[model samples]
Target: MLLPIFHFSAAAIDAYVFWYDQNYVDLPFKNPMVKELPLKSRCMFLTIWCLILQIAYHTVAFLNDVFGTNAASPKKKPTIRLIKDVLFSVAFPIAMYVSGAFWGIYAVDKDLIFPEHIAKLYPVWVNHVLHTTVAIFMFIELLTTNRNYPSRKVGLSVMSVFIGAYISWYLTVYFKTGTWAYPLFDELNWPLRIMFLLFSYLLVIAIYIFAEKLNYVTGSSKVEKNLSGKHKKR
Candidate 1:
């Protein structure tokens, strides 16, 4: 139900953007991060990427949980945990963008107002930042605290990865399509771009700190007891 809605919205927006670009003026694909691809091709690629991300996330999570084959495993070596952590962290944000959840609202709006240039691009950017920050924070929490729920962490980690990749994709589009998604970032000034990146990094760091504090407060009661028990046994 939700998926169909997202699909319809994306198609409609893409069609509108195509019309606007051809008739209205020579708008770059940067604002909404839309390309000049045919609707069919865009949808096809979206579907393919969605399936790929879904499969990859689930496969890694299942392996980690059932076989202790990845980061979730208590007995696994640090190297395996590190590799899986990096992979899982990167997959999340990208999947979210491809799933259409990241830009669904903006895609449906199509008013060409508020966000100014590329209406859809605003939501995509916000979604990417929010989801990426949250996911990375959660992943760091899992690594530092060694929580038990691999499923939850995996879900978050995959979202983070997807978001990071989507941001990179948008940067590429900004260069190639010359359609600045955000007017603030569209200036093409190196200083502004660097500032934006720095801001994003700081936001992610703040989120990580909050997550760690929350983990300490919540997990301390349970994990501490368990650790104390093991120490006593020895």
Candidate 2:
């Protein structure tokens, strides 16, 4: 709970500052994207949104534990909890791996993926915040909590909708602005771009399955075993 809240708050603030500084407060001119600032197109921003959702879930759970009250409705808690699992299992890993790979190769040469000029604006810490902290916070959650993941059917359904929505959003942005949200996309032809997107989605599915395995290995014992000298509670 604390980890996510602290990490997300800092990330969100930093992102806001980055955006503010780049656009000089005239956000509309930052990119020629029509309609409005297409924030959803940025993987970092989406990861931050996922982190915020996790924070909300933890805050509710914490209050319920502390107060000994079921203030949160039954269906509401499960729905939110499932979404949190999906985000942590799917969204965070995708963001972490994508950004990490982009910057890793990018460090060797500036013109690889990002524009050479964009690299000059921010230091290395910006990359760490965007790419590294997500995995750290996600692992912390996995290690600490006995989380119950949604069934494969439910998980995949949610995953499809989530990924599909984002693809739609970025595609719309591209159509409107005549540019890809990320520079890597611009480099690929249509067929390769479609294949890349499909491959990325499949990779996320694999990561989600890996997360389920991690949950089973780490959570099962703590969930099933009873502590000595304590009530043999379920």
Top candidate (lDDT): 2
Candidate 1's TM-score reads: 0.39
- Who wins the TM-score comparison? 2
Error of 2 at 19 (Å): 8.9
TM-score for each model: 0.39, 0.67
Q: Which window of 10 residues has the lowest lDDT sum in candidate 2?
A: 223-232
Give the CA lDDT, 0 to 100, for residue 171 in model 1: 66
Mind giving the per-residue lDDT tens digits that candidate 1 earns over 1-234? Answer: 222232234334434443443454433443343555343223213223444443444344434434433222355454434444454444433333333333453465533212555434335533343323333433432433233333446645544565456467656655765654444454447887777656554454344344434544574324433533432111
The 0-to-1 C-alpha lDDT of every candidate, in the order given, reads 0.41, 0.55
lDDT of 2 by residue, 1-234 (tens): 333354345456445544544454222225544425544334323444444444454454343334322221233454545445555555545554555556664776556555656555545565455456655655655665445566888877777787787788778767877866466776789999999879878877777788778777774334323321222233
Error of 1 at 153 (Å): 20
Summed over model 1, clashes come to: 17
lDDT of 1 at 146: 36
**What residue pairs clash in candidate 2, if any at all?**
none
